[model samples]
Target: MELRQLHYFVKVAKKEHVTQAAEELHVAQSAVSRQIHQLEEELGVKLFVQKGRNLQLTPVGQLFLKRVEVILADLERSVIEIHEFLDPEKGEIRLGFPHSLGISLIPQVVAAFRKQHPNVKFRFKQGMYPTLIRDMIKGDIDLAFISPFPDEHEFVCGEVLLTEELYAILPPGHRFSEEESIKLRELEDETFVLFSEGYSLRPIVWEACQEAGFTPKIGFEGEETDTIRGLVAAGMGVSLLPEMALHYTGPLQPAKVRVTEPQVTRTIGLIRRTNEKLPLVAKVFHAFLLRYFQERIQESQ
Candidate 1:
């Protein structure tokens, strides 16, 4: 039976009067009656009977009413869920970022976005660049803050949010600690604390060292930038890190020396799946981040 017929049947079942049901449904009485009759014919069951001046439901009619209620309720709920999904102001966003940005940038941006769109919720995934890119491609994350941008064609990159210079973090009493700016080649002989494989910064630093004429002599390997910084502070080795790493180094701040000869830096931007359009919430957040960074750039200038 058609949904219209089921709707008419439900109204009639609820009111127990065709005239009142039609009036409430804003349809003609004969139209409502015809729909109910068609539904009963299709089901091969009588749905109503006369009880003096009023109409009453038959036994089968009561059973059908219960099932119809559930079906109609589920349909209504589905419509509401679709509307919420399309709503820009009310939805969830799955966001991904590297552990370095997670220390400050991600939290600040999320807080600012929530201040205006309080109904929007966020699911955060913190990982290195490779992991974030992998998750984005797999549809596990909606959007991410990624550095140096993804080279694959499966992802689309947005405008640069931030460009941070790479610094050589040295121990407190190291020879290079007193220099105003150090060249990458100068650290060729020194032990280095490098990020583990799969981290985006490792390649950027490695390439810079290669251009400077020698590969870095790696002393230790760690995942998070903060841990690498800690290693530097403990005299384990020197490391190349983005400026953002310095902000969260706490009391054990390593000596930060700007890399000059080939001045290395990393550009961070938003990235998402190229195949699918972003959800309304993710689109809004993407725009919000672009605008936020643009304003920061203007203020800095």
Candidate 2:
């Protein structure tokens, strides 16, 4: 009939004596008996047989006891999970990262986070800023590592994690490949291999070229970084990529030269849905990214 009734029933079933069950439960014997009786009436089953003050569980009572034990165990586990999720030291956190950041910054932060909170698990998805924002709005992602200046007011964004400088990946024999750094104007006549429109770098690279007083002459477009690199390595065309792409150890081999004209940089940040209650894990990750990026900024200085 109620939680108390179920507790009394379980206690009596365990001890097989109303007096002992009541004492163990810190309740009076008559109260336990009355509650058990009420539970029996509610369930339309006689849960106990009495013989000279000795209580014995009936067949139905034994079957029901198993189910009740399972339910109580689940309730206890649910409470524990809720508390650990709030504590940040345990439970699961789902976060998103842009493709480049996922390869560079995120792994370092995740390693540090895991060292401190081994019980916590992370589910990471790779996406561009727009897709990341969409997932955050749908509550499919808790937070995201986003590129420079997320413009939408519908989400909260933290300080920059790192600044990604654009670079031109030149084939082995290009004239400026040996230069320290090349200006965007140097690529005005060069064919450009670029990623698809959804990639965060696409807009930045395009804008950087426009700032140099010319539009990009796109020769090839692909989704995967590896594919784009392959195209460049085969001498299909030169491409503008984030500094992080130089770290790629894939088959593509291209000379990386920094972009000096207008000196473009994309500041990355942690983004979350505005006005939503963030879980403790997400909050911890957000703080971690800010600290990590600040240290990087200091080191570069």
Candidate 3:
């Protein structure tokens, strides 16, 4: 029968009196008696027997009561879990970012957010901008920190978190290392160390070189920004990297010089799937990130 019918049966069986069960349920005695009768008729079993002025549960009634109790308990627990899933203060955020950005930015933001919302936890996925965008479109990740700001219509970008100037990383004692600023065209003849395919920064650097009237002569390729910097330090070749790349703590710190001819820069923005409503937790974290970046920008100025 209906769940309400099962509920009435359990209450009446517990109190052993329809009138008292009705009082506890805040309903009329006849209402309770009528529902109990319908339950018995539906189940085709006599659930109660008249014992003096009080009612006594039959053997069948006792068995049914146990099953009904378990059902009601499970339903209550399910409702609680559903509410917790929607609770903003106590939910998980699925965050994505490029390996280059994650080196310093993600750790600082996550730590600051956790201090105020300790109950909130995060599932982090690291990938290049292309991979992160694909995952966002598939609904696999809630939000991402993307560079060169995605142009696809499937994603919405927030305010630029930061814009970093591109720098020329040169080996120690190289001819260009003596200059405060170098033109992109000046490195046309020199070999270049660049990021592997699928990284967003690679295209930005390549385009800048092309705009400067020469395609870079790629001599080596690497994945991590730190590794590329190390390669340049070992005199492998020169590379154009974001200003943030300089924060990498390593013994082999390549000399960094500003790129001036075209003045190349990359903008990073927060992104999410277009037209999809974020979960309460993700929405809260998104707002937090905007504020976090704004504060950092102000402090830097």
| Residue 130 miss distance in model 1 (angstroms) | 2.8
TM-score for candidate 2, please give it: 0.69
For each candidate in turn, give its C-alpha RMSD to the true structure in angstroms. 16.0, 15.3, 17.1
Per-residue lDDT of candidate 1, residues 30-131 (tens digit): 999899888888888899998886679999999998788768756753554476677757777889988888877888899999999999888889888778
Collision count for each candidate, in order: 0, 0, 0
Write candidate 3's Cα lDDT for 1-301 as tens digits: 8888888888888888889999999999999899989988989999999998788989998888767776775675355346557775787788999888877878889999999899887889999877887777656677889887865564665557888889999998999898999888999999999999989889999999999999999999999988899999999999998877779667777888989889899999889878867767788889999899888889999
lDDT of 3: 0.85
Q: Which stretches of candidate 2 lie over 4 Å from their true place?
A: 1-87
Which ten-residue region of model 1 has the weakest summed lDDT?
Answer: 73-82
> Which residue pairs overlap in candidate 1's backbone?
none
What ranges in model 1 sit over 4 Å off?
1-87
Instruction: Identify the runs in model 3 with alpha carbons over 4 angstroms from their true place.
Output: 1-87, 155-157
**Model 3 lDDT at residue 44:** 96
TM-score of each: 0.70, 0.69, 0.70
**Backbone clashes (count) for model 3:** 0
